[model samples]
Target: MKTQTAFPANNLMGVSQPDLKGNGQGGIFNKAVKLFTVAEKENGSLIDQLSGMRASLDKLQMNVFIADKDLNLIYMNEIAYSTLKAIEPEIQKAFGLRVDDLLGGSIHRFHKDPQAVEVILRNPSSLPHQAELEFGNVVLRSSINGIFDTQGQPLGYVVNG
Candidate 1:
């Protein structure tokens, strides 16, 4: 008579639990995935809300731009891009101005005091900071605020003008 081994055979009570540690197959590790799944799902819809908000801001003749902590452009609403492009056609044309096309780009050139803008990005605060930015000959009144994550860590910045 032969005795069947459960541990070595990778079976328990006729159920097979994958050895995540050794075999690198299905296991607790698979279940440990993406704790923020629900939060992420909700966060994923933020783009829609942001778009709607941007549309509303446009209607109010406002321009909005979002940048990462490194001051890389991430989002520039239709109005922001078009308005800037119209005011600074040469700059816009110099760099192909669109969403992803504008990604990692900087709006520092548009700022009247680019260094002041840098100071704000380096500081992590929710309180909005105001700056005067130049678009060719036009001066835009810009308000910027740092975007924070769930843990209140600075994620990026939002600019509205």
Candidate 2:
């Protein structure tokens, strides 16, 4: 008679266990797999919730604009285009002025005199911050907050509702 030899294959963790037939072990293993599956499902759900929150923020009634430190428009949410009109093009389109000329200073254009664009750039981040610009029956109100990057350098601006 010839001798017979059989060895179990290694699992992902490099451990080998006997391949036993059906029993209560199958139920325990199935439950563990179900827990992992549920965990993955929860992770997926959380990602979807975050996505929805972003979409809702974008669709908000308040016009919002994000700009680089140089005042170049990097992002303009939906309300921005609808409410601010040329405001977006001035920052995003670059119009006819060179990049250097367009956004050379900052996004707080109206912070100083509200009508002082053709001649100056001013720093006005003091208290009672507000701006009023007339635009076809509907008034435009803007509040600006400067933003800095992780390096603690002024990187951009955040225009809020």
Candidate 3:
């Protein structure tokens, strides 16, 4: 006997759902369609607006990182990646986490300052903090803030490099 689990419908905001045909690719296509469709409908293209902003940030001389209230990285600009590469070895040595680890999920690996880190995560409006890394060669300036929706409730953070 086989048991079945009920999966939620694809409600990614505004994207469309793909067909679930006998072909092996239908599920994947459906997911992609739903994702994009949902993104398109958010606050008259909120996701697209953010995506455009991200693109502009890539061209900036400075780096940027958007983290959540948990201090887990949501996204990083290209310059940020460059800076991370500059200090890759030291980052890994000191925190034992690769640069990619910063991009959301499981950040306990590279952060040595738990209290300070926690503060930064919890207090989004708190003042920015400067820290010296494991090697002391890289200088990272960080700022955190609560990203509110139209209703002004704390959602995540609009962190920066």
Candidate 4:
């Protein structure tokens, strides 16, 4: 004789049950769809919040920038762009003097310990790491960290002064 367990026809979230159809592909597909929808919702909200915060950084005097693993510029707030422009006026006409148009290339000009910084960015053990940079006569203190996804995979790096 065979015994059967009674599974609910619907999930707690009120998601309708998918037809198992013996192979169970339909159920897996339904679950995948649900997971993706949830993820999209969460990411959307997070993006909105982060956008506000990124814009707020523009009001501050300190320089802030984010770069990819290869050290390519990603983003810099208004203050940071203006700071760069003050340091190098020609930069504004060359590359719009915007977020990604800093120092003609990478941020390696300031980050003296690129190797250590890369290591910390790729794999942040616990807390963030601190480093100092000198640009012209200004000394900037920065905290560096790896931008990670839900699965803890490194996305890039964020530098804040």
How many angstroms is residue 154 displaced in model 3 relative to the true structure, after the best TM-score fit?
2.6
> What does candidate 2 score in Cα RMSD to the true structure?
26.8
For all predicted structures, in order, the TM-scores are 0.51, 0.38, 0.55, 0.50
- Compared with the true structure, what per-residue lDDT tens digits does model 3 show for residues 116-157? 666665553553344333344444444344454444434444
Ranking by lDDT: 1, 3, 4, 2
Pitting candidate 1 against candidate 2, the one with the higher lDDT is: 1
The full ranking of all candidates by TM-score, starting with the best, is 3, 1, 4, 2
Residue 94 in model 2: lDDT: 34
lDDT score, candidate 4:
0.48
Query: What RMSD, rounded to one decimal, does every model reach?
Result: 23.9, 26.8, 17.8, 20.5
Q: Write the per-residue lDDT of candidate 1 for residues 1-161, one digit (tens) a residue.
A: 32322121221212233243543423322222222223334565333344434444444233556676567676775656565455455446444354335655776634567797677676666346765533334445556666555655555666665
Provide the lDDT at 1 for model 1.
Answer: 31
Better of 1 and 3 by TM-score: 3
Model 3: lDDT equals 0.48
What does candidate 2's lDDT look like per residue over 40-157, in tens digits? 3455432233233345445544555555545555555454544444343343333233333422344444344434531222232341135444422333455554443334344444
Model 3, residue 23: displacement in angstroms?
Answer: 52
**Mind giving the per-residue lDDT tens digits that candidate 4 earns over 1-161?**
22221112321111223333423533443333234334434665323333545544555344556565467666675655655554453333333445344533676644557687566667758425676544344344556655555666554455554
lDDT to native, each model: 0.49, 0.39, 0.48, 0.48
Clashing pairs in 3: 14-37, 14-38, 15-37, 15-38, 18-30
Q: Which residue pairs collide in model 4, if any?
A: none
